[model samples]
Target: MLPEIITPIPGPRSRELAGKLRRHESQNVTYLAEDFPVFWQRAAGTNVWDADGNRYLDLTSAFGVSGLGHTNPQVRAALVAQSADLLHAMGDVHPTAVKTELCAQLSALTFERWGAGPGKVVLGNSGSDAIEAALKTSLLYTGNAGVIAFTGAYHGLGLGALSTVGIPFFREPFRTQLKEFATLLPYPFGPAGDMLRLRKELVATIQRRAIGCILVEPIQGRGGCVVPPAEFLPMLRTVCDEYGLLLVLDEIYTGFNRTGALFACEDSKVVPDIVCLGKALTGGFPLSACVGRADVMDAWPPSSGEALHTTTFLGNPLGCAMALAALAEHARPAVAAQVQASGQRLKSALEKMRSPHIWNVRGRGLMLGVELIKADGAPFTDLAIAIVTRALQDGLLLLADGPASNVLSITPPFSIDDEEIAFVAARLQEYLTALPGSIS
Candidate 1:
């Protein structure tokens, strides 16, 4: 039971305030608009209400952060309980019970992959931090600084993570800092020639550069929810094995139940040397982790040696409790089954749509994308943006991504119901069919 919209998006008051905020704000990073930027008043379950009282279906899940739905009751309760006991504690110095509990649970979940070696967990405050941690772990383990990453792959925005990210636009400005340590590989998506060259180059790069690690996304999220070719990951694993390059899987977006598996590597049976997880890990709370083989993770020594990395809120107890609850909630067989079923229904509905602009629709489980195509079958970025804007006007929160940013990404909360899925599909169909310049 979602709430109803009572006014045009942003409303009069929201527009007025947005203007005032824009004056002092950077205005570049924040995507605020006078006509449409919905000011979120509150959220619960799969719906959110703007300041003007208009409710949204929450398709984007606040950038895929809310895994178990918005403001989950269990997580909220856990947060409150942990807060009452202790707000902040020295994580690396004096670990709390909740922090230890969370690490233990995560270890149990990853036991099949990490085994009982020195493989352990490193906590952080965000996805980029976790990614940076993984990057550091790789460097320390192999004692090499070089890294290989795929085109269109986004690891994080930090210096270390950015160095490994393959997107040029995001990193070009900081190229001086990233170029020396980074090597970009081709992302296997379209065209046979490009993919063939990419495969050959990847192996060559590993051998030539003496690469210490290869950072990859199980499924590229910001790169338009792009799913790689069936042979991509396994082949990369083979290359890593041959070169002794540590394989690091950035599951910040594809982890949790979003990909219908606890981890996306499960589909390909490709076990990475290091795994970086975030986004829904803490169920909307700010928590991230780098978990992997003990030898790789233990690159940093224990208290006997100085801590290489430390954060003011490293193993946040409140965040840990909420994460534990989130993990437990999604661990249920029933919840996992629901995500798989719903994702199939959503994908099927998209596949059935006939749009002259749609080039392709591909993804696994809840993380999916609809890529817009031109007449000659080239990727069309504008068309994707148009569809997203139209959907937003119709009360859906959507985004576009990829090298072109022409992918209409539909990664809603897994708790979204069947009716909501049908409604979203129907709305997009209507919008594209009626919109000006739409190919239909």
Candidate 2:
């Protein structure tokens, strides 16, 4: 029962709030639109209501932050219970029982999935923090400052993580301030021949550089939900083993059943030396973890009064409790199956369209994308934006992502009903069919 457009998007109240926010909020952080941005008042499951009372079906899952869905009941209940008991604890100085239990669960899960042997975890408040910890771990363990990263990769926005980010626009502004410790390489995304060339290049770089780690996204998320060849990850594993380099998989976006597998790396049986997890880690709370093999994590010297890397909010009791609940909910076999089935259905529908505008439709499980193209096969960024904007007006929220911003990222909640999926597909088809310019 979505598409409840009671008023124009960003209605009067939203517009008023936007004007007020503009006066105080920094321009860099605001996602300003023409009239006003859609101000969310509340959300539940896969539906979000704006300040104007327009209920839209969220397709992007609030940038993949709410995998268990917005305001998930289980996570909310955990948050309430934890808040009533223990609200805050000094991170790194005094860890709470909840933090210990959460870490133990994560370690056990990592061991069971990757056979990494009772891995250890370092908690953080965001995905960028997780990446920072992973980077430091690599430096300490391998004693090499150089790290290998892939093109179109988005580790995070913090200085440490930004140093390794592959996106030019995201890194360009802070290039001079950031250290040049990462070597960016092309990600293999095409046929066997293309993958082989990329693999050769990667090997050559490893030989020439003092690389301590190879940091990568199992399936590129912000880079348009790009899914590399199935062999890509397995090849990376082989190369890492050959070069004695630690493999760091950033599963911040692809974890928590967003991909068909619990972790996209699991599909290839690739056990990374370090795994950075966040986004959906706490359902909707700010929590992240840098987990890895015990030996690697233990490389850092024991704290002699001053810990090297620790945050103020490192495993807040509420976040940890919510994370525990989220993990349990996401671990259900039914949840995983639903994601796989829904993704397959959506991808199949897009593939069947055979529209001239669609260059490709690819992704794994719920992390899907539709790459739009012009008649000449060039990326149609304008068309992609138009579709997304139009869908919003129709009460179907969407997002455009990719190097050229020509891919529609469709990452709905795992709990989204089949009817909602069908509605999204049908609406997309209708819009594409009725696009202003006819195919030449």
Candidate 3:
């Protein structure tokens, strides 16, 4: 009894709000269509209601932030309780009891999951902040400024993180201001990708440059949820070991049971020197962590009066409490199992469709993507847009991702039921089967 579309997609109120936003906000900040952006009023579990009272099944999970589902009762209660007790605290200078507790919990969880002995964590306000911390940690630990990053990588848009992003357009405008510290390499996708060549390239790059770290995503999320070969991460670990490079894994999207494991690196048994975690960390509240081996984290000297890399909201009480509650809920065995099952079900359904337009279907757990292609095997970007737009009209919220924006990113909340999954598949089939012979 979901996806009750009482009005046209985006409707009147949404368009009005969007128009107001266009007048006030920066043009570059809004990605959705100017005239047709859906303005959400409320959300619960896997359903979101737009301003026009149109209910839709939320598949993007609000850009994968609401992993525990929108307005999770436990996380909401924790946030409320923490706000009443203590909302703000002096960050880094005078830490609160909740901050201390959250740090301890994160450290213990990292150690237990990744097998890093006595892990240490540095909390930040967002994924970009966590990536910045990891980058600084790499520089401090190895005494080298050079970094090795992979193609299709998206650390963040901050100046430091943006420099490491793989997409050229994201870095083009600020090329002069950004440092040339990172060297980009191709991430292995399948058997066609040459591991030996990549290994040689990595070795040569390390030998030539003062490279200190190799930053990569276990499964490239924005790069269309591209999953590398089984041996890719393990081989990267080997390369890191041979060259004494710190391996920094950005798990901002793949972490917290999104990939059927607490962390995607767990599948390959590859423990990184530094791991960046965010997105679903606090179940929607802004919280992120840069966790690493104790020895590596000890590179920075003890703080005196002024800490070097501390933010004003380093460990907000509300974020800490909600993060603690979210982690406890996600760590449940049943949750992980359900994610695995849901991912399998969705993948199987997508595979069954097997349209000529689909170039590939890939991903693990709930972070899935469908790559669309033309007869000539070129990326069908317009078709992707049309499909997603159609899906929206049908009361299903979908997102497009990838360098070419031709992959349908199907990341739903872990709480999505089988019926919703079936509906999504059926709607996708209907749209794809009815694709016009030629899209402009």
Which candidate number maximizes lDDT? 3
After aligning candidate 2 to the native by TM-score, how far in Å is the CA of 436 from where it should be? Answer: 3.8
Point out the higher-scoring one by lDDT: 2 or 3: 3
| Residue 389 of model 2, lDDT score | 78
For model 3, residues 148-218, the per-residue Cα lDDT tens digits are: 99888989999999989998869899999999999999988964678888999999999999999999999
Q: Model 2 over residues 1-440: C-alpha lDDT tens digits?
A: 56699987778888888888888999888887865369999999999999999999999899898988899999999999999999899878888999999998888777546766888899999999999999999999999989999889999999999988887989998888999999999877744437678888888888888899999999999988888888888888889899888999999999989997788888888888889999998988899999989998999889896789998898899999999999998878888888898788877776776578888788989899999988888888888887887888889889999888999999988777767877888888887888675253
Decoy 3 TM-score against native: 0.97
Residue 130, candidate 1: alpha-carbon lDDT: 92
- The regions of model 2 sitting more than 4 angstroms off are 191-193, 437-440
Ranking by TM-score: 3, 2, 1
Query: What are the lDDT scores of the predictions, listed in order?
Result: 0.82, 0.87, 0.89
Clashing residue pairs, backbone N/CA/C < 3 A, model 2: none
What alpha-carbon RMSD in Å does predicted model 1 have with respect to the real structure?
A: 2.0
* Model 2: per-residue Cα lDDT at residue 35: 51
Candidate 2: what lDDT?
0.87
lDDT, residue 59, candidate 2? 92
For candidate 3, which ten residues in a row score worst on lDDT? 431-440
Every model's TM-score: 0.95, 0.97, 0.97
